[model samples]
Target: MTVLSVDDIRSRVDADFDRILDVLSKKIALASISAHGITGEHMKRSAEFVAAELAKVGIDAQVVQSHNPDGTPGAWEVIGSHIVDPNAPTVLLYAHHDVQPVPDKAAWDTDPFVATTIGDRLYGRGSADDGGGIAIHCGALHALGDALSVNIKVFIEGEEEMGSASFIPFIESHRDDFDSDVIIVADSGNWSAQIPSLTTSLRGNTGVDVTVRSLTHPVHSGQYGGPILDSNTLAAMLISSLYDENGDLAVPGIAADEPVGGLQQDVDEAGVRADAGVVDGYELAGTGSLAARLWTKPSLTVIGFDAHPVDGSFNVISPETRFRLSLRTAPSQRPEEAQAALADFLRARAPFGAEVEVEPTDNGMGWAMDPNAEATRDALEAMREAFGVEPINQGQGGSIPFIPELQRIFPSAQVLVTGPEDPKANAHSPNESISLYGLKHNIITEALLLAKLGK
Candidate 1:
């Protein structure tokens, strides 16, 4: 096959922009949200849609099925492959088809299930997280056409938003099919919409549900609110113990890694305040820049609480209260170790002899890449040429459990994490969207990287 010039690939991607948006629109129209106690039928249909898209670009694709741990139905994983030569290195392209639930319908400017374009951004649920990822893979492959230099395999996951709990088992069962010399995960975000970024590190995570029981039944608060330790008060104390007076993560075993080669994140204080919707007298937590605290440090948040409903709140002291704790662990820390420490700390510090039960829900390890590898260098150059800007190396605070798992499966492979999500993309939140410029540039970037590595 003749080598396509970088400009040629860029032009090809540009020429196919309309078709790309159409593909993205079709994907966004499906409500493929994956969560506990919900059917993944939409995700299965999404897998089929992706497989059909891959087929249009001369790739043979199939939807593979797996089951949840409890024999519940699972999303269908799509696998597509096109080999140029047997001796050439294979590049595995990874993305997910599932997305997070749309929490509030009233918060969106348009229908969350429909792709609506405003200015340069395309708004919709799953538009940026992995749906954009799917478009990138297909667009790059379509542009390459038959002139492709490297063997390519696509693995679009079906349950990423739900922690990818069944992903390892799926990989083990199809280990031979995933053999490759390099893996490119296209589910991460860029540093900014205009600037290209290569994610170099990801924080690990663990979540637990804690329930505090203080009484056999609810009683009138006026009578027992003082002497009896209600579950609400006890749960509040248990939650407060996880933080220090200065508002840092007070867990014993977790600590931040030294900054990545003294590299600081590009975010600023004003941006953080504005993006977080901070109120007038609110001060930031932790020392160092917001980037340091976000990308390299551990943090804790009370994701959800199961106390008395606000509408039906009576003058009663509830007997039991449940809350879910999400703990983001340092990249250098093992999530299981941190989780155990948290459980031990909570159990030992039960306030007023309250019965505390801390049950771990999920644990995923963190990952760091060797930035000096040859493939890494080639990718930086390819992205610079494709995006017309010097690519920044960034770290993500979110955990992708599949990254660490892929590292374990293919220890020698070069792993590149690149995607189209920008700062305002708001992935996993209301009104998630992707910049059209970011999408076009990332597709070109991936195509160029494949061209350079394929030979």
Candidate 2:
């Protein structure tokens, strides 16, 4: 058995860091951002690029196609596998190639499409969120080269950012192609720099639009002052009822429990607030643990309210108003059930004699990792060897819908979430960046993991 030392992994990671950065920078420049995600052309191109790289590394690669019921190409996947031993446990590495839309260029320090390096940090739209993740995996594989002793597979999806509508079906259709003993999803981040972390849970999400219609047109406020119902007033009342005075969600049938982990540090809190531009006097919910509130408890947010604003104020009662509600449920909760419960709650809580309609827009389940698995143990050991630190187990607040679906399909596989980004990475926000030191260490950790698993 060849045990990889930290120095050995570090040397290999340092040697390939520049090349890995170059690859990621070029890939981000390709503008694979889908349009409402109906087209797969960009996805296909991204997968092809990944496949080409694998070919250069002497690994046989292929594009696996999954089509919709209408026979349209729904997803394009790149599969690169090196089967060193037929009976060895196969590991599947996953990352998404698609990026979110870059809406405001003025808010960004650098062009969102151009991957720029400034003072040891790379800035771009998807750099830390996922581009860096893909690069890490590729770099690790390149470092492993001929020393690999186990079968390895790389699977990249383009629909993850868009709800992964095609992912579950594709996995079911091509079940045999993705057989693996472990799944490494390199899309999440650590608690902070120098602190390696493993994400064990993710919050599920359900969205709904609530519309209130009380009259045909805006009526004069003076005339309607007597008893006429106002949609705006009703909308406000309904929205206000979503939460209790304690800042906890008040929706019926949804569960809220304390998170398993503790709250983030003051530094982490400051970083998150700065990145998000949160206003003063506003604070995150839950008393004891930040991670618990984020990952374990339920949260309801009004994404958008469609009532007329003060700019276009009129002396009349608005006829209709609509608001978008986004509910983040706990990892153990079912999103569909939550959505149904929300709908029922809204129907029952609507103001008397007011017409209320609740409609579900999207729903996705949360993911939980099985800790007692061989692959997880190997990964933890590998991370410890590379970072000289024990990885902290925690949970993420966001939703990665495809993760739960993948777990369902591969029940016996170990799911590991460790990536290069830290708390200050600013993923999905302006001035997004990745720490050079963190990226290098993550690359080393990944290489160590590959070497360990291969052995």
Best-fitting candidate, measured by TM-score? 2
Residue lDDT tens for model 1, 1-455 = 66789889988998999999999999999788877322456777888999999899877899988666666666688887888899999989999888888878999988999999999999999899889999999999988998888898889988888767678777887886688998999988887888898888889999899999999888999987788977988999999988888888887777777445457445678987998899989888877666668887888999999977789678988899999999888777899998998888999999989999989988889888778877788888988998898877788888887898899888988888888799999998888999999999999988888888975
Worst 10 residues of 1 by lDDT: 258-267
lDDT of 2 at 192: 66
lDDT string for model 2 (1-455, tens) is 34556686677778887888888887778766754453667767877887787776656788776666566777667767778789887888888777777778899989977888898788887788788788878888777777666688777777667666677777777787678987899999876667777777899999899998888778899987658768888888888887888677878899765444433342257656776789999976555455677677888888998877799787898889998999999888899998999899898887866889988988888877766666677777877776788777668788888788888888887788877678767777778888777788788787888777766
Candidate 1 error regions (>4 Å): 34-42, 70-72, 102-106, 211-231, 306-322, 350-357
Per-model TM-score, in order, reads: 0.89, 0.91
Q: Candidate 2: how many backbone clashes? A: 2
Q: So what's the TM-score on candidate 2?
A: 0.91
Query: Each candidate: what lDDT?
Result: 0.86, 0.78
Pairs in steric clash, model 2: 259-292, 263-290
User: How far is 44's C-alpha from truth in model 1 (Å)?
Assistant: 4.0
- Who wins the lDDT comparison? 1
